[model samples]
Target: MQTLRSRQASIAPLGIVLATGALLTGCGLAEDIADSLDTSNSKLHHVDTGAEGKESGLLADWVPDDAEDVHVLQRTTGSERLLTFEYSGGMPSECLEIDTVGSPTQEELAAAYETDARTRDFEVTQWSTEPTMQAEWWSAGHESRTTHLCGRWWVSETEGVFHAFAAELNG
Candidate 1:
């Protein structure tokens, strides 16, 4: 009877060890599968508002001076970055101006603008749709090779005055 009891204890430990080994192996396999299917290449999005939005510098030289409410979005995938800025109470003419000086062809600018808007899941009024004008400028403030900016404005009796902008920063 004592021998039987000893044998039972030894077998119980062996079973526990086998189960643990199997669990660890299954976890490793699952992790490998997950890594193979992973598509987000270090993508990240950041939002800033109010005073923080002004200080974020995501808009580079295009940050509006008289904006009543400011919202900024910065999205990054690997080394590439896209910045979108939205503000209220800014004049349409003033908001559309790009002060920085690098003339990337209109096509290039439009491509960057389209890419920025396409990657975003959220809507920014009409700005997410086809922009009335496309623009690109070089931001000396940044270390990127080039930064492109696109903007749209809305002035309606119901919606009030608003400005939306999108920029692409290439590393």
Candidate 2:
């Protein structure tokens, strides 16, 4: 009787330990799945406006020298990146001077600008509703760097607001 009771005691504790381990593992797996499904949780966003915005590396190579009241928003998820900006004091005609591929189609614009969920919330959406013109461009950075750029602009006599998007083409 004593031998049987001792064996039973050992088996009960072993069962408990196994059950606890299984529960912990199940919880961990559930958490991982939730993280994978919620991409916004993993995204990184950066906002810069005015002179500081122009100085940022994100905007420095992109924004025109004549731009003013600049507002820039950048979002990144892993290797993917999206950029949008608004500025005054630049000419719509300047699109020709930039390294653009000429006017963008409605489908191309949607793919570049509307694909990201986070970008939908940006203030630039308000300005994009009625753009005077739109352009698309590509920047093949030095060596192994390549990026796709697209943008739209609403122009007036005193202000020219531009909303642009950029993403890594190879990444």
Please list the residue runs of candidate 1 whose C-alpha ends up more than 4 Å from where it truly belongs after superposition. Answer: 1-51, 66-69, 78-88, 92-158, 161-171
Give me the candidate number with maximum TM-score.
2
Among all windows of ten consecutive residues in candidate 1, which has the lowest summed lDDT?
152-161
In model 2, which residue pairs have backbone atoms overlapping below 3 Å?
none
RMSD list, candidates in order: 14.0, 14.3
Task: Give the per-residue Cα lDDT of candidate 1 at 103.
Answer: 38
* lDDT for 106 (candidate 1): 49
Best by lDDT: 2
